[model samples]
Target: MCRWTRQDRQRSHPLNIQRDEYARRRRQLMRMAGEDAVLLVAAAPERIRNADATWPYRQDSDMHYLCGFPEPDSVLALLPGRKHGEVVLFCRERDPEHERWHGESIGTERAVELHGMDDAFPIDDIDDILPGMIEGRGRVYCHFGSEPEFDARLLGWMRRLRQLRGGGVVPKEFVALGHLLHDLRLYKSRGELKLMHASANIAAEAHLAAMRMATVGRHEYEVEAELMRTMRSRGAVAAFPPIVAGGVNACTMHYQANRAPLRDGDLLLVDAGAELDCYASDISRTFPINGRYNREQRALYELVLEAQLAAIDEVRPGRAFDAAHQMAVRVIAEGLCALGLLAGTADDVIADGSYKRFYPVKTGHWLGLDVHDVGDYRVDGEPRMLEPGMVVTVEPGIYIPPNDTTVAERWRGIGIRIEDDVAVTRSGNDVLTANVPKDAGEIEAWLKRGMS
Candidate 1:
């Protein structure tokens, strides 16, 4: 078995920003939580992949956003006005034996020194110690339902406080932390944008690599393998399961079976992204397996490209969050009608939602730490207006399943989606993944480079 060396760890470190950035995030959260509020956030639990083995450990996005501490069985507590400390961390204690077998850990003391937590404690003591911090606060801010065990413990503490209400003032209210915290996270800081840009860059290279690998007679997994190799070597992992769908498989969104062999004149659709420094980049590109799109494929590809460009152009500031989706829908509906795929006027087809048969998904979603990152799409019952510093995806597509009888025989089994990571700016939007070619001719030329 291969073992990881120090160099391997060093290469994977995307912590280019100063440690104080995490401190700044905590400060922001504390300000939002208010002096009378107590905030509780838990680190993600390690998930078991199989018998006696674990999947790769990834920290919770909310927890990692507040503090860059990467470890399991940890939690963060924020008491904004406390004299002893405003921020506290409960984390794993250092045990030499455990470190030898599992991995080295950042113990409590260093958690304070290195990570800027005001105080720290062993996770074992949290059960005994945390409730006391919650005792007199007016409100508790935390994400309930995210961790069921933590939710039960929180409720238990509340019940205990209720039972002993006569003894002293007890925290009386529980509020969801996501309301304020996620809003804060929705807007990216300059450093955060830089990290996201880096992630997009890596994902773009991986997409190009996968494109080069998708030759006729090759299994879909071969392209996926090329992607994984590029990602792992560069210290990134897939933000989500990569969709390496070939031919008919492309018609199914979220397709996972990468066992099909690519055939000449067939198209491959890859929806994959990379996660770097906890920030994610999502990109999807459709190209030909034989280095060229066939006549029918090219017609559908150009239509989808037109719709995508229109949708992407709608990603500027002040536009409604749904504007991109609406724009894409209109474009797709109009194109389908023009191609004789639909019989009515574009207006009628879109008005009645008949176009959903071909385009069933929204144009895109917010992009960040999670591939489908968190942010309120609607605010106060209205579609939220876009603002600068927000990043979102502009993906527009059409999928015609192989067995569908509604469309022409040649048009079936064609799925084309063009997605790019876009960042809203004061003037307009920036396409972070623009380096990867999306044009039909551009893609064909790039694939030809591999053959040469």
Candidate 2:
């Protein structure tokens, strides 16, 4: 039975986002204002994947951060430095015609009650009501260059305000709200950490299920099906298109053409994630299709695993954001030299950029609401230091192409990636997805246990 039904979704617990959080964020925005600053954030619209087929609806990250409301066609307005300076949500009204085709629509009253907004109004009245909301505001803070439609609407709003400038009503400045919100989202709250941990657990279970279900002669899509099924069964959704690559295809990053059949001697890379309550957990694991790694595959897998472990160890509060990447690069360089993939010494190979031949991508990236979550790692042209409550992925891989003649035939067509979600802490790093097996021996044991 599917655990992610509409009923289950409705019964889900409300996130514990206090009203003070929104008040605090608004205060911070108001502090940046030269005069009256009004911030506007819009919710994401449901996109159509094809004719009459719509993609799963997910709330905008900024909107979710402010109100925790998941409904579509919603807009949040914040008039900072005012007596009533709080959130006001503009949302869809209940209509039987649209409600019959789509699911239920939470009207403005319910939106205000459920989301703790100061006030609410029907979305259809946005054109008539928004100008009044912006009449006395001196600065209009919104996400510019984000949505062309919204940009046009903003221009029209400003034009309307300009037309009424004879009445002494016009915004003096326009600023991008993304700058402020992005900085705020860099640090996770306790509630966010709880949701992120839940997401990581779901991803871990799904990956383990895929590992156990894998076997020789099975198609890559079959493994993907198992992963999706496991995730859905656990009341979660995929964060992104799961990558199930086998043999030579594993070397292709972002490989989604999961149509190839698994070969007995080939390696399989599954880069998948589970989204729980809109929080994302990204993890990648590579193992043999037949449940036992050969000599060359084991060597490369161990190397990548070693590099990943070293990178994870470097994750700590106050460390530079690039410290883990540098650590992983050093480990990869040393491993490549040991495997004879590079000719020179470790330092020389790293200095000459020979490491890129094997490790092309970065070691990892920040993980959260989006698969590659938002946050500026560098501020003022310097690396931003890691802080507690920040979640990130540590993924390291070595891909040896099938056509590369520099290596032996047995070593070709092997790609291995080991990924896990890590949360930086004052004490150390917490491996959120540690429940999933990664060690080569444990993976083999899991396969054996499944067969038994």
Give the best candidate by lDDT.
1
Reference-based lDDT, each prediction = 0.88, 0.84
Residue 190 in candidate 1, Cα distance off native in Å: 0.6
Stretches of model 2 off by over 4 angstroms after superposition: 1-11, 14-35
lDDT of 1 at 87: 91
Error of 2 at 276 (Å): 1.0
lDDT of 2 at 187: 81
List candidate 1 segments past 4 Å from native.
1-17, 159-168
What is the per-residue lDDT of model 2 for residues 1-452, given as tens digits with 9 covering 90 to 100? 65453623543656545556756666676577534778898888788999989888898888877777788888888876456636688899989899798867778887767667778899888887788778887788899887788789888877776666476388888887877777778788887888888888888989988987788888999999999999999878999999999989998988989999988888889999998877899999998888788999898988888889999998998888888889989998998898788888999988999788788998888888888999987879998889998888999898888898987788887888999999988798899999988888988888888767
Pick the TM-score winner: 1
What are the RMSD figures for all models against the true structure? 2.7, 2.6
Candidate 2: C-alpha RMSD to true structure equals 2.6
Give a tens-digit lDDT track for model 1, residues 198-248: 999999999999988889889988989899889888888888889999888
| Model 2 TM-score (2 dp) | 0.95
